[model samples]
Target: MRNVLVPLSCAALFSLGPTVASAAPEDGRPVADPSSSVAASGAAARLAPLTLSVAIERAMSAHPRLRAAVLDVEASDGAVQQAALPPNPSLAFEQEDTRRDTRTVTVLLSQPLEVGGQRAARTALARQGREVARADLDALRAEVRADVVQAFFSALIAQERVSAATESLRIAGSGADMTARRVAAGKLSPIDETRARVALATARVELRQAEAERVAARHALALATGQEEAAFVTLDGGADSLPGLPDEADLARRLSDAPTLRRSRLEVDRAQAAYELERARRFPDVTVSLGAKRSQELGRSQAVIGVSMPLPVFDRNQGAQREALKRRQAAEAMAEAQAYRLRAEVLSAAVELRARVDEIDALRRDVLPGAREAHAAAMRGFELGKFGFLDVLDAQRTWLQARMQWLDALMKAHRANAELERRLGAPTQQP
Candidate 1:
């Protein structure tokens, strides 16, 4: 197998994470840590939280899809070897009644000679095909990394929601306690106390729902990392701060480096190589035979040498060459289409990321703080009997909604930035 270059890893945490890259493959596959033997042993030590970079590496090292793709590189390598070899020589023996005093015996050897660079063409085509597969592996690696990031953040956001729900439940419980006391003191109506109890019940329901979502998210993250649901141990990150993204100008340049584009380019090269191979095949090879003929009647041996070749009168490979040309044309068109599609994808992701950033900023910088202050004031006013219990309930609802919305926006922004990281082929704040 040819040397396979593993695509660089996108270890940026919203452009802030560490860079953890896999080394290039010597035989068209990333060399996994031979100590993946450690996975079985340290699998027990995974009781601690799993970080995103480590998770991505683990997925690459162990994912079944990644391992299967490596086999293609190996198969292509075998094909290249086969294509580079000369045809094996054939040996034959014959006995005939010569219509003379003695029977005749003969031995013949024949070797097919591949001329017009057919072997070279076949080898080149196979090499180009191997390149296409390697590029595909790089693309798959990028996909796996992107999926890990998305799933990790999904779990993180679910965690944040659970926290928000837990905090809301605590506030609701506190409110209910105060309402019961006010009713006993004849300062608040019993009907209002019932409303406070109902509000507490709703908060408990939301908390349960949030917890369920968190559990589901964890399961999903585990699956994305190629583990059992129970195997992730724990997720050790928060979604409080989304990482920054690269600007459009920089992203445009980076986007061209994406594996999808590189793979498309390789496709074109392979197509051209195929065409060359077909063109080389249009020229026929020669079969040369050399042997010794023995005749017992004469008690003599004769050496014979001869060559045979197919005439180009018919089946000149024009049809196959035409097919190869058409395929090459299609490959070129597809390459162009792939480039355009990548540009569109980068532009779209950048636009959405900017909007999410603005939305999250407004919610955090303005909406959330005001909502918090309003909820706090409502609590203080209710304690002083200056505001109705209904007013406190409304404020609490508003505050919870604002916090959840802010968390949601932050998740979106992170996801959009992750898309940028995928489309641009990598993420590092320094870039």
Candidate 2:
């Protein structure tokens, strides 16, 4: 993925005019030639086109949320390291005086050792926690990518709508011109011209609406890409042709990689590890220390060792272990529920996608052309004085309505395509 940024290097090189060598100074300081440099630097500040993929990559690299998530991973890694380390050593010093003159001093060092695999258990728990955090970061990245994809598609759809509206306006204008010519030739009533003008006005309104939608879509794309408005550009690719629905077996395989499902599974693993850690705590950890001591009366040094262990007389971690177990059970249930929901969503989206594609095909092939032919016939009849202005107006209205329906069908097909891609965890194409 290329980072979305203007090529300042190119701009600088292109913006600089012919560079002139500076004349040497006689007084030990050279005069600066800043004309070319200033021009180059100014040009480097101009906006450049950025594509959707590039924008997404740049945002992923620079986004504050992703950076924060990365920091959390590092913090969790540090926690794991701390858990793996042994307890700090202990040190002691003693001094004694005997027989009014003799004195002895001793210094001792001791290290406390963890017992009952406490270090290993704690490290395991920390490792699991780190995994959970990493999974969370992955989920966030996927969400960001999905948003960028959707925004890019929406912008493309808006552009297409604008194009369609522009064409409709042209058609309406042509209709108005034809009506005027017929009225001047005394072949049609003035009421027909009025109707045609009304249609043209409606077309202009639709064009304005389409333009507004395109502007809004561009803004959304800018937000998703973390780019300035001037840097926004059209996506490079068109909508991908709808693919055949996946078989049940294939869909099952693909579902494993779904971010939601994967996150839920990781949560289950984390909960299970937490439960085990709690259980391990039921066996108390022992701390042992060894040291050396000196006696002033005997003028001798002796080694001393001590061991301490927390007795599970009162709190055996039973309550904590039970709570952890319950949480683990809940996590498992949640994972199962997510899996079910994902399956349903994938299936539903697939069904809807197929229906939308079929409808678009039917509208394009059967309905729109028929309406256009009927409108042409009605226009010819009115010009020949075989029909009234009302008949021609009605036919034009029907044709316009059909064209709008066709545009709507296209939009639905695109929307369904987006939904299917989202459900399948597929990467979106350029448009």
Candidate 3:
């Protein structure tokens, strides 16, 4: 297995949190880490909170899909080694008759030798296949890291919502208390008290819902990090302050380095190698025999040297050669399609991420502040008998709605950034 080169940016984006240490493969192959194998289980029982980097490391180590990919690369290595080996020699014994006095015996050893670059072509094909497997492993590592980042953000967003809901609940409780005292003192109607109580109840319900969502989000995060059971660990960091997006030109330059496109290109090379192997096979191989022959009647032993080759008149590997040629053409076409698809996806993700950034900025700079002011003014006006209870409820609703929308925009922005990094096959530093 090739070494897993986890991008430094995966940790840099969350520099506020702890970092995971990456280990190189031993002798160009993965060695099972007993500690990492149990990392997820240990993390589940941890007294401290979990960090994004630690989650990613645990997933990389214990995730079944990632482990399978490592095994695939190892398997490809074995295949390459096998393909480079020469054919084994065969031994034969012959007897003309069962009677010992008149029996004639012969013994020979034959080795079928590959010719016309057959062995070289075969070895090249296997090496190309190994490269393809390595590319796959690289792509999967990126995927796993991206998934952990996204899941961590999702849980963090949910935690923020829970806080928001709790704050709203406290405000609603205060309003209910104020309305009750006013109703008892005859400054406000009993209906006002009822409305305030209802509002408080609604806030409590929203808080409950938010708490449930937070629990679900935590479980999802645990699953993303390859835990079999929900860890329910506190997330160490927030996604409120993320790095800025990369420039369009920078993203364009990264498109060629994406693992998906790289893998597709390698598939083309592997297919070409396969075609070469097939073409090489069209020429027949030679088998050379050398040994000693003994005749019972003459009581004499003679050396024998003979050579044989298959007649290629009937079978010239035409079908296999044609199939391999078509496959190579197909691989080339697929590589083109993959490149086009990656470009489109990167463009879309960048556009969405920019839009999300704009939206979040608007909500934070304009909408949320305005809504909070309006809600506060409405509460003050009601207390002074200048506005009705209904106005206060409307203002509070608007403020909460704005906050939720802002959080949602933040979540989308982070997710769009994650998607962009995933497509690029690495994390990029934001300027």
Best by lDDT: 3
Candidate 3 local distance difference test against the native? 0.87
Please provide TM-scores, in order, for all candidate models, with all chains considered together. 0.87, 0.78, 0.87
Query: For model 2, where is the 10-residue window of minimal lDDT?
Result: 17-26
> Hey, what RMSD does candidate 1 come out at?
15.5
- In model 2, how large is the Cα lDDT of residue 425? 57
Q: Residue 170 of candidate 2: its Cα lDDT?
A: 90
lDDT at position 235, candidate 2:
58
What C-alpha lDDT do the candidate models reach, one value each? Answer: 0.85, 0.75, 0.87
Q: What is the alpha-carbon lDDT for the whole of candidate 2? A: 0.75
Candidate 1: lDDT of 273? 94
Flag clash pairs in model 1. 13-17
lDDT of 2 by residue, 1-431 (tens): 13434576566656663343224555758677799788666455323444556767866787677789999999999999998898888787777765544776667676666656667878988998898888878777766666666676677767777887897789788889988998898777898899889989998999999999999988987777665666645556453343355567766777788777877888898898888888887887666667776666676888777778778899999999999999999999999999899889878866776787787778778988998899899878866778776787788778877877765665665565556555555553442
Which runs of model 2 end up more than 4 angstroms from their true locations? 1-71, 92-110, 181-187, 239-244, 294-301, 379-389, 428-431
